[model samples]
Target chain A: MRKIIFLISLAVVSICSVTTLSAQGIQEKSLTLHHGSIKEIHSTLPTCITVANDGSDAIEIVFPANVEPYLEIEIDKRDDILSFDVIDESITHRELNAVLQKNPIRVRMSTAVLSDILNTSDMSITFEDGSVGEWFQVINTGTLFVNGEVLAAKKKIEYYNTGTFTSKIHSYNTTILCLTNTGFLYTNGYTTAKYVEQSSTGIENTDLKVACEKLSISTTGSGVIKYEGTVDDVEIVSTGRAKILTSKLN
Target chain B: MKRLLIFAVSLIVAIAECSAQQSIDELLNREIDSGTTVFKMAVKRDPETGEIIKRVKEFTTTGNKQLAKEFVEAFESERDNVDGWEENRNGGVVQITAVWVNPKRIYTITVAGSALSVFTQTIYREEDKKSK
Candidate 1:
């Protein structure tokens, strides 16, 4: 009877240890949306996220097996809108792929993630709505399309469009570094500073309607910039018949 | 009796200071209505000092121009006590920047063209002065 009691205690200890080890390994979470639209998907740190339209009714996220252990996903529904927040707890960088339906879902991320993914391989994302946050630093070597707001508050958000880049940007206090090779950018927002550097044989057209405190524009080659807003300060350096058009904001 | 009088005065002064200094969250919640949709609110801190350097808040009113107008007016009322205040209006867009000295912070408010969205940011004066 004594030997049997010792054996039973050892078995209980072994089972508890295994259960604790399993809990510390991989953490997976899921939520199925029955109603409401997805308002935003926000990530705490810079993460490599691939969003693709699968034409499904429900939003589904599939994490790669290798990096699944380091991600924490949370969904909050308030006032008939779903807000998805992702926190990346990994010290090392890893790729995350998410497939969802195209309509009524907005994905927000730092432009650094897009730059990282584009550097590794070619990626194209087509969705209904998307937004780029404040800390954006991207050098695009491929086609890029953004049909949403590019917001910056404290630091200057920089983007080097060196490929076929097209965007309808509502910017705030951001400096778009350069636009080269088939770049078409339409901007309308509040800007403290704006720098436009256009070059190459490809025509770069920038239409800006902004309430700007200052604007410093430098254009070369077949580049044209149109401006219409209340600007406190303006500096323009143009070569090769580059046009800068300004009209009063009505 | 003199010591008791001094202690009472000290307690009153401390309470007044505490009531005057309101945090960013408290200030916003008190000024703005709860029905407004809060899009995002984020803060950045100094890594070394663990001091909050910046606070940003974005919200949409869903085409409620009256609410947006009221918010701008509420900030404008405090212009007399601020260190610096400036208001700019270009067509339907309005931008306001105010610098406060007590907490040493700067506030920037922007109301979009349709008055459907508002973005506000508060930055520490020390950080702003350092960048300048």
Candidate 2:
């Protein structure tokens, strides 16, 4: 009975996690990018636990940087898989072939179970194609940040709603970068126009300005924010000074 | 001329160092502009190593069926609310917004030279209701 109940919960969680994988009408159960990569990982993994999805290798569970990762199913089992390692190198998508060869594991897409993936890993790499390849990672909304300023008392922040529904602002000024239905961030200037409320503007997103400093930006509502481009280093420097450059990415 | 050359080299090194100091947002914006649907992005600061790590994942969509509505009058239509809220389809170019859906967390997204960077700040109340 315990095993049966666990299976039922896993099914629900898997349902929420799945989306369309291709245009050929093929439905994949659980997928790890490296488990399917054509380039071989060269067997760098210390140990690989293999589980098959249908007939093909569905998932490759390995830690490229060698770190301890814990998977706790929030809904069903408290712990089903657990391993800890000391990380040394960084994990990148290009190394998928090397890692998967040693850790050819699979994701069990059966039922709904609450699981939060926690890792003590150190590094990740962004590919030239703009895609970030992460190891021992699962995606979910977590926290907010502040840049372009020291992130002190009363920093300016603006929200631009590009999406339709007005973003649901739980509250404002009270949080680090004031989160809503769309995006997250932080600030260090003072401005009253910084409205983080549950309601939203009309179909079009409005540009918000707090401190002439352009402390923060948002898309939780329906608009876009235009500001000078500054890396984190520059953002942490003196405020009020704006930058000018015709910035474009290829 | 000698002094000018030395000053210019120092300035170049400083700028190069700053650019290499890419944050979680810069790396992410780079991926999103290339047509990746960034679902969730997180940052962690290690007290031991003092290294901050940013992690993100992208997924293809099947177009969820959000609660749709109808407008009785043409001008008073709330229909566009659902059609083009998160993504815009202009003939061919599909421009998608990178968003943070977590409550109390504010995310600022910016784009520069083919790269997009997002910084997040969490909102909390002094009285402390929840999500603090």
Candidate 3:
């Protein structure tokens, strides 16, 4: 009887260990936000977030399962629109991966998360008042308007400009490219307008006022680019009636 | 006597140009020995005109703050020899861009933060084109 009991105990221990190991592995969880709902995300720790739009009426957020224990989800109905406040309560340093889809949302991240990377497409994100980061990349077709002070080290913005893109980016290196159709881009700070390549039928009107160390502008469309800044070295290439005006060269 | 005076003036100009070029070469040698070349580009020219347009080369010293400071000081020491010099500071970052122009070419040096960039632009002379 004692020998049989020992074998059963060993089997139970092995099963428990396997279950704990599986739970510690990577897993995912998905949550849905109703259409036109306002979702505000706040993280206590540094987090990397990627946001995109799929034209769905509801907003979907898929996050790593490990972060679920640290998350606090609250929803309230105000003026017929649901508002969600998702707060991260982790105190230790861990990378929280949150991928959001569809609908517009507001995010407020602290300076500890400044080194985090933000990737966005086909959606609108408004940086609250004063937000800083190391890298922010915008690609594909959509509108991105940042009405705040964003101090970053590098930014690469590719705007199809189905809508307007206006931001104040203070970065050491910045590259802006406007492609297809017509749109407006306005920016101010220390800018090195690396290359602005436009198609034949594309019209992108850009106005930039910056203190530039090196300015390189190239355009091949009917776009008008007006620049005002203190420039050290400049190389301008324009064709097809693209108007380029600079305070120093104009 | 007029010919002799002109020859003396030309000799002085040649000596000055040689010394300036030698200093630049020495700085480049030191950079090669101590720093790492992060980026480099050869001189580019217009296809039809064959006129040299631009060349860019950049070097970094990893995270050695002392070596970076030494490079910045060495570049600043050449400010008096260049035609134009401008320095802009934002927070902890410093940017220095200088232009040196001669009868045959234009050179620009830009130092942003710890990286040093050098650009060269060749001036197209009428006599040289005719000879070609």
Residue A140 of model 2, lDDT score: 14
Give me the overall lDDT of model 3.
Answer: 0.43
Backbone clashes in model 3, listed as residue pairs: none
> Ten residues in a row with the worst lDDT in model 1 chain A?
A4-13
Lowest-sum lDDT 10-residue window in model 2 chain B: B66-75
Candidate 3, residue B21: the lDDT equals 36
TM-score of each: 0.33, 0.18, 0.33
Q: Give model 3's docking category.
A: incorrect
**Candidate 1 off by > 4 Å:** A1-134, A173-202, B1-132
CAPRI rating of model 1: incorrect
- Note the Cα lDDT for every prediction shown: 0.44, 0.27, 0.43
The lowest-lDDT stretch of 10 consecutive residues in candidate 3 chain A is A4-13
Off by over 4 Å in 3: A1-106, A111-122, A128-133, A154-163, A168-184, A189-201, A247-250, B1-132
- Write model 1 residue lDDT over B1-132, tens digit each, in one string: 999999999998666444432443344553332222333444555656545576655555446666667667766766655677888888878888776554555566678854544455666634654443
User: Could you give the candidate ranking by lDDT, starting with the highest?
Assistant: 1, 3, 2
Give the chain B TM-score achieved by candidate 1.
0.58
